[model samples]
Target: MLRQSFTEQGKRVLKIEQQALIELEQFIDQHFDHACQLMFNCVGRIIVIGMGKSGHIGNKIAATLASTGSPAFFVHPGEASHGDLGMITRDDVVMCISNSGETNEVLSIIPVLKRIGAKMISLTGNPDSTMAKLADVHVCIKVSKEACPLGLAPTASTTATLVMGDAMAVALLEARGFTADDFALSHPGGSLGKRLLLCLRDVMHSDDATPIIDQTQSIKDALIEMSAKGLGMTAVVNQQRQLVGLFTDGDLRRILEQRVDIHSTPISQVMTRSCTTADADMLAAEALNIMEVKRINGLIIVDKHNTPIGALNMQDLLKAGVL
Candidate 1:
């Protein structure tokens, strides 16, 4: 029996896979560039097909491509031979993944794909194998060795394939100038999407919910308004209802320490005249950045006319999942 500890064996596997990735770098030649350009120029979606373990990696690659603006989907090669090939179109690009470059299930459908007139890019460990020779562009993902001690499992080769897929997806994303907002649109349910798409207008406490008080109002009146709205602050506006200042719980503490009379003192006299404010149309993420930089817990959203339209604090952002 092997005497190596579990930790030692784990480290051995990692080292083997690491070396495989290092060797995989040399295979990113002109063939890889041609494959990317083919996918980039395709008028329709990029279709990725592989069998077994390769198919799993292909699915992830297709998803990465789709979210990064390349628009791709995966079709199992076995399924492809079973009427799923109808999904492929002449205007699309088909990517085939086969470690040996000789997957029987994968090879069985190449002739049909060729007949469909779709461009093909082959990702395989063997550059001279049948699938590579049949492909329009062949990308070699040859690895030095398998991470499995017996050299039977698909660890290193699969890792190399997945990393190569990531490289291609990112390269294509850069070529397309895919922005974070574009990526967010494709992932609207994810945290990144919420952070990118959520605007102040979408999360701010607006209308009657906005805490506002006249500049001439007493500090006690501002406190009442803040307590009513529960935003920890109140916007101080002039007779025109245009924002002039802000008063918050911090100001109340400062007043308390000074022993000032809230009922007699006007809010404008104690309010923060030069305060951090955000535009109503600004993204909530941007607002969060501003609040963080200013070390404040609340924000006031104003329009082009400098009129206070909305207000929010950290709690509002947390509730909206912008935190």
Candidate 2:
């Protein structure tokens, strides 16, 4: 019975929060556009300030803005009062977040921020609150009711504020033409960064490490080259070093079944002539896609002139963190 009651209460909370978000959709009006424009046109960083629970949400909002192409950082309102206020500059914009817009710690620094000549934006539940009145632009994050049964906790309000922050970040992101490449630059240690930034040239084995063999070479010689390089495959090239075919472990199995003599049979007779290939400049993620769709484990990197320059396999991608 207790578990059932707890589950019902949790469901009630989620339902209330969901309705709050649905109502928030109506609030994305001219004011929201004005806030986005303010952030998009700013020449300097955005300084986000808040207190207590609002401070935690503000921190996340600042991080989202910074990672999405907008220069931003969070500043505790209490810390700002005690000398950290120097971080604010005339060219910067200040975003103040307070549920009631009457947080003493935040209101106390308003004068100093004004003196610094920073533009102010406010996110509050009350549109007529003091912070809203003082700000250059105001965004309302009001919720119809608190998700907490007691009606005191900040559950719904905090969720609304977070959604509003995301709305603003994405708006500015699109306005600035922020591409995946640009986002990857800011997140070099993340998976998306590796997918977008790493190319075949960055992970492929080139030069002597590339298993290249003359197309006229016997299957025995091709196997020797493949074993020496350990790429499970060898690129069959012409006398002029032009890629003609590929011989892999799978090819070896088929030839063995056909009873071909490895010492006398030329590799070109058994190698795959229409092997999948990638350019050196192609993204590693794109190469992975090709390998997956073609159901092949190995891929050869070719130059513009169709010369075999490098080679990589699924194992190579795993080592490079592209998998």
Candidate 3:
């Protein structure tokens, strides 16, 4: 009986929050457009101010905005009054977040922000509230009801605010032509950055470390080169150093099944004539796609002239955090 009650209550909360979001969609009107325009046009940073729970959401919104090509940062409402308002510049935009639009701390610093000539954008649950009346633009984030049974806690309202912030950030991102590479610039320390910014030239084994052998060389010589480089593969090149084919451990296994002599057989005879190759300038993630599509574990990177320049395999990508 207790488990059923818990399940029912959990479902009820979700339904209420879902309804709140549906109604919240209507609030994305001209005011939202005006706010985005203000942010897009501003030459200075976006300073977000909120109190309590709203502050937490504002911080996340600030981060999202900053990462998406809009320069932004969060500041506590109380701290703004304590001289943090100095960060506000004439060209800046201040995004004030308060569900009731009546937070004392947030309201107290408005006149100073106005004196600084910074634009004001108020996100509040009450469109007719004091903060909304004083701001240059007002965005309503009101919800029909809080998910809390007693209707006291800020539940559905906070969710609505968060979604509204995301909408603004994404809208501005599109307006500014923000791209994946631009996003990666701000997030350069994680796996996502590596996938976007890492190139084959940065991770591939090059020069003496690259396994390259003449096509006329014996299969045993190819095996020695492959082992020495530990790339599981060797590039078969002609007299001009132009890549002609690839010799890999997989080819060796296939040849052994046919009772081919590794010591005497020419590598050109047993090498993979049709092989996948990549350019040194290609992104590591792009290389990963090629490897996956071709179902090959190793790749040879060549120059524009088709000369072998580097070699890499799945393991190298894994170690370089490209995988």
**lDDT (CA) per prediction:** 0.93, 0.95, 0.94
Higher lDDT: candidate 2 or 3? 2
* Global local distance difference test of model 1: 0.93
TM-score of each: 0.96, 0.95, 0.97
lDDT by residue (1-323, candidate 3, tens digit) is 99999999999999999999999999999999999999999999999999999999999999999999999999998888888988889999999999999999999999998888999999999999999999999999999899999999899999999999999999999999999899889889999899999999999999999999999999999999998999899999999999999988888899999999889999999998888899999999999999999899999999999999999999999998888
User: By descending TM-score, how would the candidates be arranged?
Assistant: 3, 1, 2
lDDT of 2 by residue, 1-323 (tens): 99999999999999999999998998799989988888888898999999999999999999999999999999998889889999999989999999999999999999998999999999999999999999999999999999988999899999999999999999999999999999999999988899889999999999999999999989999999999999999999998899999999999999899999999999989999999989999999999999999999999999989999999999999988889
Which of the two, 1 or 3, has more lDDT? 3
Instruction: Choose 1 or 2, whichever is better by TM-score.
Output: 1
Q: lDDT value for candidate 3?
A: 0.94
Clashes (backbone N, CA, C under 3 Å), per candidate, total 0, 0, 0
Kindly provide the TM-score of model 1 when superposed on the true structure, using C-alpha atoms.
Answer: 0.96
Leading candidate by lDDT: 2
**Tens-digit per-residue lDDT, 35-98, candidate 1:** 9999989999999999999999999999999999999999988778878999999999999999
RMSD (Cα, Å) for all candidates, in order, is 1.8, 1.5, 1.3
How far out, in Å, is residue 159 in model 2? 1.0
Deviation in Å, model 1, residue 284 alpha carbon? 1.0
